[model samples]
Target: MRRCPGGRSWRRAAWRLRCFRFVKIDCYSIETNIQIFAVCASVARRCGYPNRPDRGGGPMNFSARGLSAMFSVLRQRNFAIYTSGSTVSLIGTWMQRVTVGWLCWELTGSGAWLGLLAFADMFPSVIVGPLAGAAADRWDRLRIARISQMLGLLQATFLFVALVAGFLTIELLFAVVLFHGVVEAFNQPSRLALIHSLVGRERLGAAVAINSIAFNLARFVGPAIAGVLIATVGVAWAFALNAMTFGAFALALAAVSLVRDDALAPRSGFLREIVDGFAYSVRHPGIGPILMLMIAAGVGGRAVVELLPGFAADVFGAGPIGLAALTSSVAVGAILGGFVVGVRQSYTGLTRTVIVSVFGIALAVAAFTVTDTLYLGAAALAVAGFFMVTTGVGSQTLVQLAVDGSMRGRVLSLHGLIFRGGPALGALLMGVSSEFAGLRLPVAVGAAILAICAFFALTRVNAIADALENEPRN
Candidate 1:
């Protein structure tokens, strides 16, 4: 007779008693019979049920159909709020940019000051970006973003009031621009950091691409609208509308539900955190190269945006409409570039894509410099925009994918600095060059530099492609 374990033996006895009622059994064999019944019951139970594995292991259950369904559920309302708000706000912002550039041209009639003003407005990001990045990592990003928007609103209102009171001077405008630049320095880092929270990690790339799409779309529309508005309603209305647009974004931000995660590292002393962030970024091979590429692009290529007014006034001989068209053309190309990225499912070989884009942008800028016709110049600008967006978005995706959750905010802040600050430096250089060599020369020089950089980047494409190919699986 087989002896059953203590708990199983009792259950076996009960089963045997039930069986005995239907068929006769010897007393000596009762224990053996009971043990057999218990073994059979246990085997049946084991075969009928199995334990589930933990979440991390095993094949993921998501199919293409399931993933599509999931994305459809999560993206609808949140995307609308983010995309629409940014669209409205960015249009107003671009309009103000065009109007301000035109106003600067009107005041000094010097291309150098135009560059200086653009530099003043963007340079602060470089100076303050490290600190801002640290703050973004430590602080509540949504709150910081909201605060920055409010400050921008205040600046726009101040500009509008000053313009209306007949107290507006070039110096005052420059001062206002500097103040706005400071706010933007802080705002941009926070905004970039906050994006991850709006959508989860799986959807981050798509979200970034979509955001770029919205921004470029606004870029396409805003300058054109601003051109018409500035010509018809005056610059004051542009400022007024800009102020109102900021308010709308603020409202939209207030309406969104942000889930805060407390897993990030605690805030440290400002200088200490900045040092840590810098060290971490420099040590990261992937992030380091991407950052360098961004800086090069910013300094070498992005200065063209600042030169639009000069191009319109001196080269094209068309007024606000020409300026608007030039700006919009770039934006149109960018929008198309972003759309292409958004539609693509894989990010494989993105480095090659970026290198191609840089080369294409340089070639377009060079062509624009030589082209005298407004239509031809606009077409060149459009092509430049397409390449610019492709390069910008591709680099952005690479950086975001390389960093860890803890380093996202600080690293992204550095990204914003390079992105915004590089352009400021370029504008300064171009502005100085324009003063001595004429508008076309500075653009031509920038285009040549971009071409050189693109060539160098392409040379390293295989190494970059290999690195991306071996990126850590999320």
Candidate 2:
């Protein structure tokens, strides 16, 4: 009952949560009442829980109002159905993903392997994503997504049953990861393309933004859940839960119908289209450098994400929960980054944001690397993750602002590849480096390199913004 203005949100939440832990033993006692009261007041006073104080000094429930405001595009029936379903599905996907990292670390205890697992999981998107984007023009986007998710479900089942059977191996893990990566390679493009079918051009931005928000939200929530489940139920059930959630996404996809325009489809051959896409990405001054910057940041800053499981087990000496906190810190930072961008809503400033965020990531990574304690490491990671998202979203926004309408598909596909594949390669290199030099050295080096590249890229700020100013759109 003491006022503590200096108490940070995390500290407040931590204490209130500890108090709540004793509530089950004395559900109706004064202590329990106090615990509940503490959590509610802290959440309202400190955490942004969509509640506001009334004129009469009482809090009003504004959670629904907040949700509606953030996701106004969900007013469309199909968009709502897909976003809701996909959000659930993505949470499970993240859980399985976190479990995979934990399981890999448990089996191998190698930072190299942690990086390898990340490479196995995400590298496919880099390799096959552009082809998939071209293919999505020919195939039904919804159908492709449904099929890809089914394949993902199958991959999850294998991991679940294998882990449960006590026959899982490192080789088997890589194989499953590679196959699932292939599935995601196709799924990413189809899903992105599917948005056009669900929402008109007028609201496409909101739909796209909401979809992205859901994915990042899962990035935070899923790892937290995985940590709990891995601590309690083991990793097998994590896979099983992930497999089950795919059904929700499948059903949602099946329920929606969209009319495809054959005329809008690609007329060029796949090979030439691929060549043309490559040309467009490089020929432009703005798109080319942004893509290049993405690659640098992806490898140097973003790929540090894959190293988190190693941090949890080796550095933090905690299990799934620690890993969750580590990974979720990044996601939390990323979510905050999204809010920062949304709130600022300035186009001219975004180019600088891209550079600033890249610098921020480097600083966070440096802090994380040198820290002697887990709390400091997690805090640093959260800060780094925030920069990661800002750099990512900022670069993408710049690309869109500067891209040609005729080259939209190829440019965006390249964006996907640069961000996804670059990180995969970065993880592979960093993972190997971590094995030799240890986690701190390789990570610190990468962050330092990224800082240099980000600063160097600042030389092109005017060109990038000017390109955006004169961009041609379809």
Clash totals for all candidate models? 0, 1
- Scored against the true structure, residue 172 in model 2 reaches a CA lDDT of 96
- Candidate 2 shows a clash count of 1
lDDT of 2 by residue, 292-375 (tens): 888888888888888888877777775556677667766766666554443332354556666766777777888888975765
**What TM-score, over all chains together, does every model reach?**
0.83, 0.83
Instruction: Candidate 2: give the clashing pairs.
Output: 227-320
TM-score of 2: 0.83
Superposed by TM-score, candidate 2 places the C-alpha of residue 434 at a distance from the truth, in angstroms, of: 1.5
Question: Per-residue lDDT of 379-451 in model 1, one digit per residue for the tens?
Answer: 6777677677777877777777767767777788898898888888998899889888988888788879878
Question: In model 1, which regions exceed 4 Å deviation?
Answer: 1-76, 260-262
Per-residue lDDT, model 2, residue 296, is 86
